[model samples]
Target: MDKFKKVQDVIASVEADVTKFYEGGNAAAGTRVRKAMQDLKVLAQEIRAEITDKKNSAK
Candidate 1:
């Protein structure tokens, strides 16, 4: 639950950064935004894994 919350927060932050980058019109910002988005995606996957592991362990 806590991990999911943290990941969700990170995702929100990354989303905000993406929006800022899109509005800023800087080429270099694109790379940073892409990287942040990728990291957030990976964090989401990790959160899924954590939930799955918890479920499996309970069973």
Candidate 2:
């Protein structure tokens, strides 16, 4: 649940940065968006692994 919350927070921040970049074309904001995307990808992988582990344990 904590990890899910963290992923949600990162997603929200990325959405904000993307909006900022699109609104004013800020290069810094674009960079931040990219970094946030990388973080999101990592978090997604972690969640996937956790789910897989849980399923295997259940079986």
Candidate 3:
């Protein structure tokens, strides 16, 4: 749970940065922002996998 929260916090922080860059109107920054978003998605998937494994193991 703590690890999951930490990942969520990182994703939220990166998302905020992405929004800032996009609103500032920098094309190159937008590319980086998009890449960060992609990474956040992967983090989310990993967190979900961890949760699923815990659930399956409990049974």
Residue lDDT tens for model 3, 4-58: 7767776776776677676887677677777876767887888899999999999
Please name the candidate that would achieve the greatest TM-score relative to the true structure.
2
> If both were scored by TM-score, which would come out higher, candidate 1 or candidate 2?
2
lDDT tens digits, residues 1-59, model 2?
Answer: 77789999998868877988999898999999999889888988999999999999999
List runs of model 2 lying over 4 Å from the truth: none
lDDT of 1 at 54: 87
Q: After superposition, which runs of candidate 1 have C-alpha atoms over 4 Å from their true positions?
A: 5-20
lDDT string, candidate 1, 1-59, tens digits: 77667767766767756766789776676777788667778878888898899899999
Clashing pairs in 2: none
Task: Provide the lowest-lDDT 10-residue window in model 1.
Answer: 10-19
Rank order by TM-score, top first? Answer: 2, 3, 1
